[model samples]
Target chain A: DAGITQSPRHKVTETGTPVTLRCHQTENHRYMYWYRQDPGHGLRLIHYSYGVKDTDKGEVSDGYSVSRSKTEDFLLTLESATSSQTSVYFCATYRDPANTGELFFGEGSRLTVL
Target chain B: GESVGLHLPTLSVQEGDNSIINCAYSNSASDYFIWYKQESGKGPQFIIDIRSNMDKRQGQRVTVLLNKTVKHLSLQIAATQPGDSAVYFCAEIPSSGNTGKLIFGQGTTLQVKP
Candidate 1:
C-alpha cells in the first residue's frame, strides 16, 4: 500500500456549510489526484496537483477547489456543501508524470450533506 | 467527448470459475490502461495495468488484455474466490498531451458465489 492517508473518514454537514478534506502522502509522489465516487457514476475526477503549487481542474471541478501548498499535502474544499455533493471522495498518487504507472489510492472519505 | 465504459453493470460467477470483465474506451489515442478493484466502503485498489504496446500482461491469478484496434480492455480472474467479489473499474490515460490524468469508466460489480 502507498503511504497515503485521508482525514475525516466520515463527515456529515448541513447544506451551505464549508467542508474541507485533507489528503496526505508520505511517498513523495509527484502527482496527486482527488476523485469522487458515486453509485452509477463510477469515479469522477475533481481536481489534481502536479507539483507543490501547480494545480488543474478536472471534469467535475465545479463547486470544489483544491490547494497543494506542499509536496505531501493536498486539500479539497467545498465552499458551500450541497446534497448533490454527498459522495465518497478518494485521493490517489502516482509517481510518474506520463500517467503510465499505477495510482495508489487512500482509503476514502465519505461525506454526507444534509 | 471520449469516455470509458463497461459492457455489463454486474457479473455473477460461481466460486472456482473464471471471471471476465470487459471495458471499452472511446479514445483511440489512449495507450495506458489500468484495472482497479474496490470493496465495499473502501477506495479503489490497483489490480493490473497494461500498456498499449502490449497485447496482454499477466500477474498472480490476474490477466489484462488490451486491443488497440477496438479500444477494448479486459480483465480475467482465474479461479474466482469469494474475496474476488467487488466493483471493478477500468481507467485509461491518453497517449498524446496527457497531463498525468486518468479517466475512469463505470464499474462492473463482480459477485463470486459459493
Candidate 2:
C-alpha cells in the first residue's frame, strides 16, 4: 500500500452544495491525479498535477476544480455539486509520469449528492 | 476519438480455475498499459503492467499480454481464488509523452465461486 490518505472517506450532501475532497501523500512523488469512478463508465480523470501549483485538466474536468499548493496535498473541489457528480473519487501518485511505474492509489472518497 | 473498452462486463470462474479479462484500445499510439483490481469500497490496486515493446509480462499469478497488432490487452490469473474476485480495469498511456494521463476501460467484474 502507498502512503496515501484521502479525507472524508464518506459523505452525503444535498444538491447545489459545495464539496471538497482532499488527498495527502507522504511518498514525495512528483505527479498526483484525481479520478472519479462510476458504474459502466469506469474511471475518468478529473485533474492532475505534476508539481506544486501546476495542474492540468483531464477528460472529465467539467464542473470540477483542483488545487495543488504543496507537493504533499492535492484538493479536488466540486462547486455546487449535482446528482450527476456523485461517484467514488480516487487519488493517485506516481514518481514519474513518463516512466512505466505504477500509480499508487489511496483508499478513495465516496461522495453522494442528492 | 480514442477509447479503451472491455469485451465482457462480468466473468465468473470457479476457485482454482484460470480467469482471463480482455481489453481493447483504439489509440494505436498508446505505449504503456496497466491492469488494476478494485475490491468493494476500495480504490484500484495495481496488478501488472506491460509496455508496447513487450508481448507479455508476468507477475506472481498474474500475467499481462499486449498485442499492438490488434490493439488488445489481456490479463490472466492462474488458480483464481476468492481474494481475486474484484473489478478489473485496463488503463493506457499514450506514447505522445503527455503528463501521464491514463485512459481507463470499462471494468470487468471477476467473480470467483468457491
lDDT of each: 0.92, 0.91
Could you tell me which residue pairs clash in candidate 1?
none
What is the lDDT, from 0 to 100, of the residue B36 in candidate 2? 90
DockQ of each: 0.70, 0.73
Each predicted model: what fraction of the native A–B Cα contacts (within 8 Å) does it retain? Answer: 0.58, 0.64
lDDT (Cα, 0-100) at B103 in candidate 1: 90
lDDT of 1 by residue, B1-114 (tens): 879999999999999999999999998877789999999888888898888789999999999999988889999999999999999999998775555578999999999999
**Displacement of the residue A113 alpha carbon in candidate 1, Å:** 0.7
TM-score, every prediction: 0.96, 0.96
Query: Which residue pairs in candidate 2 collide?
Result: none
Output the worst ten-in-a-row residue range by lDDT, candidate 2 chain B: B93-102
Q: How much is A80 displaced in model 1, in angstroms?
A: 0.9
